[model samples]
Target chain A: MTVAIIHTGCANIFSVETALDRLGVPHILAEQPAEASGADRLILPGVGAARPAMEKLQSAGWDAALVAETRPLLGICLGMQLLFETSEEGGVECLGLLPGHVMAMAAFDGGRLPHMGWNRLHFEIADDPMLAGIDEGDHVYFVHGYAVPVTNHTVASSAHDMRFSAMVRRGSVMGCQFHPERSGKTGARILNNFLEFGA
Target chain B: MLAKRIIPCLDVRDGRVVKGVRFRNHEDVGDIVALAARYAGEGADELVFYDISASPDSRTVEPEWVKRVARAIDIPFCVAGGIRSTDDARTRLFAGADKISVNSPALADPDLINRLADEFGRQCIVVGIDSREIGGEWRVHSNTGDPGKTRTETRATLEWIEEAIERGAGEIVLNCMDQDGVREGYDIKQLTAARAVCRVPLIASGGAGAMAHFEEVFRQADVDGALAASVFHKQVIGIGELKAWLAQQSIEVRP
Candidate 1:
């Protein structure tokens, strides 16, 4: 399958690229609109504030191209956070692919900042291929402060401070709040499944 | 609920797994791949490969060795030490590690922690709290998970822990360097103290020497998991046997 990792300039391109390469698929990293439009799938990955992310996407015109892609597209971590309509991280507008807002993770004076490490993924829907060949109680990796509030579109959920969206999908667009590239074997399976259009 | 984890920490130097005491044991423990697989099938909840030396001499972990074990172990694994940059962390994850632990970096580049947590998510970040008892007070130590480095005093130490959480650190692995390998057991007081200060689940490291040491950690500190080395290396107890015992104690473990 033709997979394009949207290189709007801030995502962890190598990690995702390495994951796909390990899976034996040479992914086309979309640096320009023309390159992105040529793939069967588009992956949006990011690592910085939503403001810079959207700004770059606009300058590169990848955001418009992303909304146009009909093939299955996967967003990882910041990539997933970008799928929402807006994010409080710099108050930047997003792709509006999924209706929601991304804000800072909840914190009390004493609570830890930035949720990191392996946690359980609670499946809100059990019949998807994204987790195919993976176990029901598998531990997926996560690292984020802001998360989408569990909405009608959330396919899986996990609790940390509070229950939030773990994975969200609607038709061809899917996003994981965790980094599949860093999630070990379980992550690899998700990437492969994303490429194969389900596990 | 998911099962409790059993992790075996292997200190690496050059390209071999080495065991240490008080952070200085210096003995080869056979091939990392073989050792990892043995513990894995024996039901080790996870594996921790800590690069013991971070000096310029050992600038990076043997990536090929990392690749070997990433292919060897099927369960979750964490790579720590010398991981101060995105490229450093990226190399290990791409080579197959499940998570990356950083303490010095988390303290140094506050934004990197946030960026990583933001980019990767909390589950992939493991912040190490190398604590040492200073005049009966537990202090967070950086660049020394084994008590060799001096402690830095800063109000942000605690806030930094919180910042790590805010930026996306999901789990905190507290390595009680003071109690490490002392075997009397975990620095329950220190572990308890750190646990009380943070809402995130804690992984107790250092001073686990017996089967009961595991029990003491679980009973004393509300820890999610325990990491040990000597006992695992000497065959003093197997992960399976240890979990069986925990099961008898009514402690939940991954079967």
Candidate 2:
């Protein structure tokens, strides 16, 4: 099966491509919506802020195409934040595929900003296909200053200054605030699971 | 809870990983890609590669090794040592590096940090400071701590750290030259002092002799991460063993 990785022109997508290569999964860098729509699965890999990323996707016609996509699609980091209704970062409206708003993480005493490093995932939906082989309290890498609050769509939750959605799912649309491509073996398993969708 | 990170630093010269005592007397370790993959298998949280010979002439790391390491290992790695501009940072990042660390260049031009943060988000810009205690005060050193040529800057360690953060450095790697490669322990006194002023994630480098050193830094200093070179390169300490010991000490670490 072919997997299409949408190029959002945000940050490096080479790591994600290399992860797919290691998994022996055939993938393509889909700069256009048609290439993405024609693939069996889609991955929206991004980094940087929300507004410019959204503008790139919108200009590339991915916003409308992704909104209408029925196939399994996953968003990573800023890509995940863009799947929501809006973001506190850049104060930009997003794809609205999921029903929530991304807000800046609250600052508490002694808590560092950006919430960088590895954190445990506390699963809310243990049996979801995306988390099939994953266990509770599995550690994943995260680097961000803003995150979405825990909502009904949250499949797993983690905390820095406050608890936030670590992984979210709504039908075929899924998002991971952490970079699975950079999270080591556990992350590799998650990507492999994404490749398994609709197989 | 965010687990404290354990990072293995690889100092590369002529494309071979090397380790030295106090940033001198360099010795070859192994090939870069093999060691990287081995460390990832051993459960290292992340890796940092510093091209020791890339400065003064070559202003950027070779993209070939960065690409090979990215293709070999699945974990996140940071590339440091000779990144001078946004184009250089972009080259490393596009070649698959998760982060770019600036040292001497950032000290020379603090605005380089601001520019890198502006181009690629701050989260990917790391400021690596080589510090040494001179006249009872910690001072920043330039040129990778080469005693013959390394110049001690007038910028105090704490002041530079605060300035770097204000300039949008997402992380700070405090490499204490006095304690580096000595293997006694991490410079807890300096680390604790830096942690107080550092709002960003602080990584302690230079003096990691045993697993307890890692514990001591995480517990007493409360730093976000601890980095070492010789211990892991010489196999004096195993990553799995160190992590298991840290987890038992009630310090959160990736298992």
Candidate 3:
């Protein structure tokens, strides 16, 4: 039942930490890659640029360890972007845990660059454990410029300037472009589902 | 498409919530955490706690109070006021504020915006502008806490918005001093000037009297969010009822 939040040392992990705290879920802040193995699940949380984030991960040996994570793992926002092969943001390489590339959200269509605020979701699958009890049109808060392309792994999609993957999943690994922790009650449910469901 | 957001602002002074609200079933009516959580339950899209505390001592209480409120609610909340450096912004974020809103300090040192955006990402940095109509034009003014003399001097409003965006400001909050507390409505002319140059999301602040005012701002101005304090604080308008009303007006709002 132990959950570890991987601290990318890039963006503030306080919001994610606060969410877990409110849920009363026992968790640890895994600063180093080695610390991640002790937990039953790992949550990679981020919110800043990819290049410096990637460098931090590489320095902390998380780049190698993240690829080796056999436990159920979740990546949020910039954390989700880093799980991809490469990012158009600063032209940086990322952990190749998932397929497709990270491109500017505006590249899909010219809209607001950040694509921030709360938007509804259209779930690809009606019943995903990570999205358990969450409805098709439930609104979630988003705040990111770069996004992962809609691929086979995409479990849900949201439209801003154009349609983009809101949530992506590949086996034991899951990633959400929105801040589930900051999306109110529905977000709390998603996080709770993740804690209950195992690899 | 992103639904238009209705944000309730709380004024925190001397590390305590300034509004005294008596919600039924709650013993501590003045509890900031309780009040904030109620707003979140009432479908407030977001919350902003403007720190108006001017005391040099007891600085720790502000961040601690923010932590309590942020922990109590699941939605994003931003902290503004007296933040002059990257360290100050980082402290607030670490205390659980999702974003940092800066005003006068940013006007003084524009590079502080770039530094914060570089460290915390542009999404978390919000540049707050207090502007007033001076002479024949709308210009930016710093808050001086004086009603009669709110406008000390004028800076080019549109130019400042462009410069803030260039400095990596993720969002712009246009607080019209002319409309502030007047409740006439948002300064349409000033907002129009801001919309022309603002590339990021624009949040309209100051001068919201009733539901119609909110409706008018959304209809007239292409702003993303509308923020108000006393209306919500004094229970002049309930967040739930306001959102329902906005929804009925054909304005897309999160229910």
> Number of clashes in every candidate structure?
29, 1, 0
Q: Compose the digit string of candidate 2's lDDT tens values, residues A139-197.
A: 99999888999999999999886889999999889999999999988999998887886
> Where does model 3 sit among the CAPRI classes?
medium
Output the better candidate (1/3) by lDDT: 3
Per-residue alpha-carbon lDDT of model 3 for A13-119, expressed as tens digits?
Answer: 87888889888877889879777666899998888899988888898899988888788888999998999999999999999999899998877876765777999
Q: Residue by residue across B85-141, what tens digits does model 1's lDDT show?
A: 788877876666767888765666767777676665555778887767666566666
In candidate 1 the C-alpha lDDT for residue B81 amounts to: 80
Name the regions of candidate 1 deviating beyond 4 angstroms: A8-15, A47-49, A107-113, A131-136, A182-189, B1-5, B32-47, B56-79, B82-129, B139-172, B199-201, B234-255
- Which ranges of candidate 2 are over 4 A from the true structure? A107-110
Which pairs, if any, clash in model 2? Answer: B185-B207
Best by lDDT: 2
Quote the lDDT for A157 in model 1: 86
- Please give the ranking of all candidate structures by TM-score, highest first, separated by commas: 2, 3, 1
Q: Per-prediction DockQ, in order?
A: 0.16, 0.83, 0.72
Of the candidates shown, which would achieve the greatest DockQ relative to the real structure? 2
